[model samples]
Target: MPRLNAVLETALYVADMPRARAFFEEALGLSPFTADHRFTAYTVGPSVLLLFLEGETTETVILPGQMGTIPPHDGSGRVHMAFAIDAADLAGWEQTLDAHGTSIEGRTHWPKGGESLYFRDPDGHLLELATPGVWPNY
Candidate 1:
């Protein structure tokens, strides 16, 4: 059976696109590879981080036969996502977060010998910087 190799994209909804863009640009130091009024896509490692405006993901049928209706949706509440970092770079990440005046909500020392730094984005999305061993076979 065919299996998935990796996750190529992840999305987070934002009420204000400019604010979200600024946070991802200035705070996270991520430059958008592709962007428009509706959404921005940032390349993170081999994956893409998509910041989309809330309730804007409605269906746009480009072709009648090939494309089907895309339902509109909006995200609510806080969302969570984690970024894996080099074990040696954990301290650097902490320093970066500090430099940006981003509060570290919590830190975790996993039982399996991993470390994680937790914080929130401008949209109250829980973001994490974790060391390699945070997950098995990661």
Candidate 2:
């Protein structure tokens, strides 16, 4: 049997491409590794964050010359995703978010000596920034 590696990608569907792109790039400071009319991808540490235009991924994608086929997939409504942060940098993150005019929707103090800051993306996805101790393996 083969072992699996960490999650490589996370995707969210957005109605507005430019708004969503600006929020992640300007607000969150994520740089896109690739982008096009249909989707944009950003490098989040070792993983990739993908933002696909709503209703665009309904059909399978063919790689120009039979290189490969990507099956269709998309999402709707609000969803949740979290990012890991250093314990010491939590305050900086808060200030950055504030400077970006993003409201902190909620926060949590975990029993294991961790903290979390929750907010929403431009597309209404519930995003979380959590400290190391929030989970057993984090």
For all predicted structures, in order, the TM-scores are: 0.89, 0.97
Top TM-score hit: 2
Best by lDDT: 2
Q: lDDT (CA) for every model shown? A: 0.88, 0.94
Enumerate residue pairs that collide in model 2: none
lDDT of 1 by residue, 1-138 (tens): 999999998889998999999888987889999988878999999999999898777656254786766556567678999988889988888888899889999999987889999999988999999897788976
RMSD of each: 2.3, 0.9
